[model samples]
Target: MGSGEHDRILDAALAEADTAGLRGKAVTPFLLGRIVELSGGRSLEVNLDLARNNVRVAAEVAIAWAARR
Candidate 1:
């Protein structure tokens, strides 16, 4: 990619980081969508992050449910 393309991508990422909402401590989906768009449609990294976080949250929920049972 040319310097122009790189600069544009960087600019887009910075723009996204600007508007991203903090959900407790992490960036929201809307912002992540912008990032994935800017990242040449590479979303697997984001998917992995979401999946990992989901797994942890699910495990916590399951533990809580078991405790209540």
Candidate 2:
């Protein structure tokens, strides 16, 4: 899906979660499930991509930091 579609789905899920009074521990799972439903499983793919990117960035940062020691 396009970035705009992803943003729309994520915003809708977040709004629903807010309206439902989801807080703290309840928020993550609720938003994730809602996004999956709204995006027809595309959200999971995006989430995996984001997670991979995060890991990659962290690894790069750690390597840089270690090199500075």
lDDT of 1 by residue, 1-69 (tens): 456765676677666666664354354565556656776665556578889999999999999999998
* TM-scores vs. true structure, each candidate: 0.41, 0.65
Runs in model 2 with CA error above 4 Å?
7-28
In model 1, the Cα lDDT at residue 54 comes to 100
lDDT of 2 at 41: 94
Best by lDDT: 2
Per-candidate clashes come to 0, 0
TM-score between model 1 and native: 0.41
- What's the residue-level lDDT of 15 in candidate 2? 96
lDDT of 2 at 10: 86
